[model samples]
Target: MSPLDDEAWEAWSPHELGQRLREATLPWYVAGGWALDIWHGKQTREHEDLEFVVIRNDADHFRAILHELEFFTVKDGTTEYLPPAANLPSDVWQLWGGDMRHGCWRVDMMMEPGTPDLWIYKRDRAIQMARSDAVRVSETGIPYLAPINVMLFKAKHCRKKDQIDFNFLRPRLSLEEKEQLTTWLNELHPGHEWIKKLPIS
Candidate 1:
């Protein structure tokens, strides 16, 4: 669960947030439910907040672009504002961006492991792909996670929203994408219900 103060936080659209980081040279892509909406080329459902991913190694570059917002480290259900010079724990990957005045979280940033050329799946580092293969850009310049990759992330939870996402994306996946998703699902979550639904090739 996110430790966000709903009333105090103001959400930004993916494009809006992307524009804020236009000067950044590091690779970043929108993740979570919003990514799915971006892939569909329209809003499919209401989103609680927006999320994007940056490589762990590029954290400093990411911070440089979003310097106006206060960054907080979220770990073990507790949230603490990160001092400008403080180092984030190795196990802590999620950072919440807050408004300077009200301290309300507006962006949820996920720090992933990889380089500019490779995208290493955090759950299983063995599962890897070229960074180019893992993300795609919208016509409007918003970059988002590939649908198959996003579905793989959602498979572990399978919450109501996850189910909705799965149902919506299942029919849209290409044969190759479905095969790739199924292979990873079987390797990472052997008995996941989603595997049964994936088309056999």
Candidate 2:
């Protein structure tokens, strides 16, 4: 059972993540808004929660590692308790970890597509990259998903916060990164305004 029996959250910082998963044998990378912040080398905006990813096959492995917390599968605004020994449903990709000791939610465990050695874009599976290129380590020793991958995910949603992230990150993209994003966006989101915003050539 969840400690509080209610939905509440207090996310951990990237530093806390480093301490917790330092010895994890498989790859794990800080994801979502926090990832972008890590790439930018500072907290550029407020984050409502912390998120991280492991290869889909390793989701349960992490759930066991963070034994102090219990995981609940989140799908379309509803959450269901996921028993420790059970497998995550194929359709469920997000798990909210409840901090049993603290009586609040802590982090989100995103079970993204792709193997530990490769990164696949969830929105468009055809877009791929070597996993080494998909992740970057911060100076503080925290691993984070690359900014371009984060931006690609954000572009699909384009919520207010996503727009803010794009605004801040667009100027920082390298010529090659911008070109890559442009090509992918054209294939997946043709006529997207962000396309126009990117450099032409």
Candidate 2 positional error at 37, Å: 0.7
Report lDDT (CA) for all predictions: 0.85, 0.86
The local distance difference test score of model 2 is 0.86
Tens digit per residue, CA lDDT, model 2, 33-86: 999999888899999889998888888778888878889988987788888888
Candidate 2 regions exceeding 4 Å error are 2-7
Score candidate 1 by lDDT. 0.85
Candidate 1 pairs with clashing backbones: none
State the displacement of the C-alpha of residue 107, model 1, in Å, after optimal TM-score superposition.
Answer: 0.7
Alpha carbon lDDT of residue 200, candidate 2?
48
